[model samples]
Target: MTQTILYARVSTSEQDLSHQRTQAEKAGFVIDKVVADHGVSGVSTRLAERTEGKRLFDMLRRGDTLVVRWVDRLGRNYDDVTDTIRTFINRGVIIRTVINDMTFDGATKDPVQKAVRDALIAFMAATAQAQAEAVKEAQRAGIEANKGDVTKYRGKKPSYSRDQFQTVIDLLSNGAGASAIAKETGLTRQTILRIRDDQPAAETALVKWGM
Candidate 1:
């Protein structure tokens, strides 16, 4: 019998593992098991290097399905992510992502289909790496800007935590309105607008406040 396993990598204590699982379940994936690495920096840690990540390799078998929040969860960067996904597919383990409802299968032998799938994989992996680099750069800049008198760097502290800020950004990317996001995240409409209008500033605020 085949099983669907959900894999999550939580970078900080603020990140919610249950939120990832909830998102996957909401996407209609009937998960048989969940493996997670807590407080693991996905940007710097290879999948195989993670404790739970290693278990994924040993636990998964041919015909099993692996689900992740995004391609970035699979590895540290473009090469690592692409290599990891390819490795799973080659092992007859199907890979799926909740964010984009993406599926990768190695069972397909059609040349055109294979080409399209490979191209998509490369594009997504490259995008994931690019986003990670951008966030790292932003955090560096934020830290520099807050070198002295961090409280004054961004004025009043933000009402939201890093995880809440992330949730707002995710919803905004999906075209959710400020009012809707405000309700969903329990943030004020003004706060949502502020974050939507100036995301970098919001991120800087979070960093300055050590959120």
Candidate 2:
């Protein structure tokens, strides 16, 4: 009745899937199944909107447990984050985060216990939102700082092949939208558009750097 299901997410396709997978594995979870959402920015609080997110609803069950590397993986918005966790609780699912070793459940019958549980959920959700906002603000500042000068190097390496780039182009040329390409190729829309714009330099960088 109690088992672990893994969830991993990345803001961009260039991020390596193996990294998250390793984290979950190292945390002592064999990962009976994995739900991965790619190219969905953490700044967005709607976990359900992520491509692989909906799959979680289908794969997880009442008695099963949900596992993530961190609480932020559940959501970025405070209300929605708390609601999502509590929803799973109502359905008899236990939510566990590897980073903090936290657990949330709906097994208590006492009112005070319920109040404590809800309070904890609210606090975790608010902290997740604050963390998300902080990351977003930092990214915006970095972009603004680099807006006038293309002098510094971005630590992230690009990832894509010429053939891969052409695939995106062809998909677009055939009238496929960004979302469609993302679903089909497991590449993010931002990645697809970059290829569509014919950035040969970017394409090469994608190959050389493996974004």
Candidate 3:
């Protein structure tokens, strides 16, 4: 029988693996198994280079499905993401994303449909790379901004970590209420509201504190 597997990459040890699983389940994916790489930098390491990520290529069968939080989980950059998706699709594995409920299947013989799928893959992969670059740049800027007088511009440290801030952002983007997000993340409703009110500022606060 075919199976569905969820693959997650957490950048820091503090990031929660169960949270990714929960997000997937909440998005309606009935996962049969989960493979994750903790403390893995998705922006620097290719999927094939990851410890648990390599297992995905071996464990997945042609009829099985591979699910991820987003395309960025599959690779380090645009080329890596595109190549990885095409490789799986060519193997007859259906790839899906929880974020947008996006699907990419290679079973279609129709040329037009294939074109559309390939185009979408390229677009998403490029977008993932762009986002990674943007975050990297933002972190660099934040670091530089506080280098000279750490006390002067550092501002107050945020109560939440980087991962928690990201979780709040993701939940908020999914239309989750402040109370629900606070309950899930173990954060105060006021903090959730603060994040919801200004996501960029929340992210900046986390980066400023080096969280």
Instruction: State the C-alpha lDDT per candidate.
Output: 0.86, 0.69, 0.86
Given candidate 3, what's the lDDT at residue 197?
77
Model 3: residues with Cα > 4 Å off, grouped in runs: 148-155, 161-164, 175-201, 204-211
Q: TM-score per candidate, in order?
A: 0.86, 0.68, 0.83
- Model 2, TM vs. native: 0.68
Model 1: per-residue Cα lDDT over 1-211, one tens digit each: 9999999887765556787787788779999999999888888999999989989888989999999988989999999999999999999999998876889989899999999999999999998888777767876776587788655555787899877887787677667899999999899999999998877678667755656
Better of 1 and 2 by TM-score: 1
Q: Which has the higher lDDT value, candidate number 1 or candidate number 2?
A: 1
Where does model 2 exceed 4 Å of error?
A: 1-3, 152-211
Give the C-alpha miss distance for residue 115 in model 3, angstroms.
1.6
Best by TM-score: 1
Model 1 residue 75 distance off true place after TM-score fit, in angstroms: 0.7
lDDT string, candidate 3, 1-211, tens digits: 9999999988766657887888789889999999999888889999999999999999998999999988999999999999999999999999999887899988899999999999999999998898778767766776687788877556888998766876787777677899999998899999999988766567656656656
Q: What is the number of backbone collisions in each predicted candidate, taken in the order shown? A: 0, 6, 0
Clash pairs, model 1 backbone: none
